[model samples]
Target: MDHGSSHDDEVLGKAFDLRLMRRLVRFLVPYRGLFSVCVLLILVLTGIQSGLPYISKIAIDRFLTLPWAIVTVESAPGSGAPIPLGDDRYLVEISSLSPELRKEWEISGVLSPTRYLFVEEDSDKEGIALEHPDLFAPIAGGYIASESALRSLSPSETLSLRSGAIAGLIRLSILFAIALIVRFVFGVSQVYLLQLTGQKVMYDMRREIFGHVLRLPLSYFDRAPVGRLVTRVTNDVAAINEMFTSMLVNLFRDAFLIFAVMGIMFHLEWRVALVILALFPLIVIAAFEFRRRARAAYREVRRQIARLNAYLQESISGMRIVQLFVQEVKANERFAKINIDKYKASMRQLLTFAVFRPLMSFLSSFAVAIVIWYGGLNVLRGSLSLGALTAFIQYVRMLFEPILELSQGYNILQGAMAAAERIFILLDEPEEDRGGGEAIEEVEGRIEFRNVWFAYNDEEWILKDVSFTVEPGERVAIVGPTGSGKTTIIRLLLRMYPLQKGEILLDGVPIERLDLGFLRSRMAVVLQDVFLFSGDIMDNIRLRAEIPEEEAIEAARFANADFVEDLPDGYRTEVKERGVTLSVGERQLLSFARAVAFKPEILVLDEATASIDSQTESLIQRSLTKIMEDRTSIVIAHRLSTIREADKIIVLHKGKVVEEGTHTELLARGGLYAALHRLQFAELGGGTDPAPPSPSFSEG
Candidate 1:
């Protein structure tokens, strides 16, 4: 394994990749209806949030602030713009004038510099207005008094005269409260719907990735770590979920808020809106720098995290070996080194956020200051209402708020892009060659390997020019010394790995032409080490097939796995991971039972009884003759005595076939097989009883 491939898998992804996003979006297609509703809710929620500040502006300008201004209109224009009071005094709403119109009136010396409040002629306030007759000007149904003159009256008297303004303020207050409540309700709905959509999309992506992984050729697993593939299905897929929920949803919401805030600001006061809008370039520059640095920091953090997770998985899986070898200290040091690297990378990411957020904060404040400085001058000159100025300040803050969220959204996108790249790379690996192959219902199981050459890596051949044939219904045994490519023959026969040269044929049909799924269904392999899943004995025997319980029991009986009947649960006995609770001989029995349940035309045994005790060997020997009866069987044995009754035995030395004959014939020839037989029998004190071999063979 080129360890650099780990880093290569960790592609430093862009903050936004259009192609990757399009692929990610494919997951959402299934839930598009709900996704579209969520987007619509975001728009509706943004309008409500944006309107909240405008509600405050309405409360301030129309009801709270001084609401009347005296205008000298030269005896009232034909448009009836102002309500005439008397002697050139006309009352006009101060909040109604545009900045341009207000400037025209001020230049003509018609707009009043002082603010005023109107007193409607009602029983309570009329008497109070009468008391301030000197400052209050009589109108058609009320009196208008300058704000400065109202201060001269007693506090109780002023409050009495301004009761109408208080009433109007109460109504606007009620409206503002209602808007806030509506915003809260819709905000909650929007968030819930968005998160639910995100979860569904993640579910689809994970299922697809897992199914694709199962179809991948076994050779791919030889190059990729189990932990790496697990991370792709679990951690990497989850990161994409975060991106969908956090970044994609918020991208719409924050953009809508920013645009709505700007529109409201311009509607309230354009000059102040322009002042804040000008600062956006500065905001853009700061945010660009933040996103750039944050992407790099975030990429490094993700890479380190993946590395740490891979290391931790390996350590936990091999912890038993580490303790047995007293390498605990060394393992801890290696883990600490990786963990510290992760911590340092995390700190760099934190530092990036620490610096950028404050910088964005400074920009937000700078925009506020500009609004205050420029809009305040207009307020003083009587061209801009104080209500609009205050609203402008609120809108400026709202504008930068979206920019801040976008910075964080960009950060999520960076991680998501990298994760997505690794995931898609795995998905893009062509699924094993299951297509374009001929399908067959059955085969005679006359398997042949013709001029086969193979290697795990480049040019390191495990089998060189190997050719052998097992005729239909013939029991052929392959015997060899350790590391002599015995197991490789069985694996190649099953097409576990592709051959570099020559072809494998089943019933004279090239194995490659047969559909992979159909071809594998014809053979059953039982190895020395049996792997069991976390399930009951029945499931292990049938292997999740449609085989009935009766079939499983019959198969177990045929394989002489009778110990299962003695167990407390019998065929229903629960198997632990890898059947660690079962004895070695019992696991081998289960393997045989499972093979029988599959009902294959061919049986391949690779030292299936190589690690059994003498009593268990006698127990299994009785089943072997019955189980392999009338079947085309190919067996690899290290114990020479086990294959003595075999119809024919082929002996391999190194990567080549050295001798081929019956066991007695090979012994008479006194070749490599004969030497090995003599050596083994000598170790057993010349006894004919075949004991289990000391060495187990697996071609690497």
Candidate 2:
């Protein structure tokens, strides 16, 4: 097949990548012993595969046909020493003659193509030969006849006369059967061992990649698509496994088989072997071209598969959003487009195979034809045995069979190389800096953010030179407008992102100096939108921590989450994905329960009660009063009424703290806090304002 049809067919160099392969070989280190066994099995299997044809050759030359040839050495001189027969004839053992000398004699008209079987005197078969005396001719110490003459005998007599040959054929059949059984046993063992090695390698790679991903900074995941990362863990790794199991194994087996076939062919008949090898250059060229095309096709196929998987993952995950917005049709169209792209890529790959398969078959047939045309004549002239010629045909087919498989190997190698490149790229990313600092067992809950400035993008500050302090056992409520960097402050306090300007300290020590795990373990945050894994309610509350079951129930009770006891399964009820079966208020209760179960020294609530109903909010408010009695609590809420009784209320407008006092004091001051309070007071139909009215946001 001509592989230049594809526009993306770049270069033959891409067909094999050495650098990538060298890196991939590191995974094979632990399994090198098993891999060596696979290679050794390849040699054994190839030898057995090459021997089957020769077995048929032996049956044909030694058992089915006559062994003696008539030589007319009286007139033309022949090379081999021949026994002189009466009447200017010579009895020649054709099997004993060298190929060249036998052909020379036959060409010189000394050797006759007519073969004869000689029956020894005093043997059991001699009785049958004597009865058919007309067909048998007298020889020195034996009786001889052409196979044509023996055919004139009766069936029972023929069977008796050829009983020795029948027994030999039976022995050869047993030998063939034994070879097949051994091949089957070893073949199964080889496949099992090879696949085992491949699976182990895959397991190691997946584990390493997953562990690495977990250690990477959250910023990397912020921009990276979840679906694409999933592909790295799954599809990409499987592609590399294909390389190991199918391509690598087949490469070793095919090379051994090709060389084995070649060596045996030359041994059987060198001249015919040369004729078959004359077409070797053509096979090489075709393979090289096919490799280039196959690499391009495989790359395209993998790319399309990644796109398809990514789109499907995203669409399924956002099916709720798609349906809510009535975008299901658009989603389906997009999915169909990606699906069609994968289909086209797969069709292109199939087309490459379809063309190459038949081309290899043609070359195989061409090779066979040359062998038959050349070897047939040599057989007739007594130079090549008919057995050897038949074996040559089988060997030619065996030689080209691997070429067909080699095409598939090319695709496997290309796909795996691409997957390896992606996987290595991900592995090369630096892990999150794990705060190479002190591991503190405990700390007083005193949080301070000093002159902090930050932004997700370059210098577009989300927080600008902000400073705040929360003393030990203090409840602080931060009230702000929607885009007032309230959530950004929480993220900075937790060290989810680095500070651009100033520093954050926890209990007088820089937050970055504290071990990351220890820092996070000491504090717990409950946000408005709660997240839950697929598990029972109790498991969700306790998570991976060694919290006692009774402690979890107590935490749930403290969060006013006793509603679970009213249900059929109670705390053991199965939580579907993200706790979808539970109501929003119930999920919030679970979140609060989880935070309380941790018994963190510091607690953060980011608009925790904003999304709940009034009844649930009242329950949460009562629970909050008890939970924050002695804990350091930071609350960011939009509902101004919720913070009226706080120990301190900080009013923030556009990343700056404009007012700092208790809620009553801020309302008395009549600043941004009083204006925001009045705006909410008018909207909620409250009776009157506590202080003199401040201008609303638009009026101010």
lDDT of 1 at 509: 85
Q: How accurate is candidate 2 locally (lDDT)?
A: 0.81
> Per-residue alpha-carbon lDDT of model 1 for 1-700, expressed as tens digits?
1222357546775778899989988888889998898888888888877887777777777766787777887666333346787788778876566656666786576887677877778856677778768988777878778777888888778766667777887887788788778878887887898889888888888999999999999779988877788889888898899998888888888988888898888776677788788888989988888888887787788678768766776678878888999999988998898889889999998998899889888889888898889989877776666777888888888899898998778867777888898899999998898734887656787888899999988999999888888888888989887788888888888787888999888888888888888888888899888999888999999986699989989999999997999999988889987798999989999999999999989999998888888778877887877788889999886655558868889888787888899988988999987777776676666536655456332222
Compute the lDDT of residue 126 as modeled in candidate 1. Answer: 74
Q: Each candidate's lDDT (Cα)?
A: 0.81, 0.81
TM-score of 2: 0.89
- Candidate 2: count the clashes: 0
Screening candidate 2 with a backbone cut-off below 3 angstroms (N, C-alpha, C), the clashing residue pairs are: none
Q: Write model 2 residue lDDT over 165-283, tens digit each, in one string.
A: 78989999999999999999999999999999999999999999999999998778886666557778887799899999999888888988888889988887778888888899899
Clashes of each: 0, 0
**Root-mean-square deviation of every model:** 2.9, 5.2
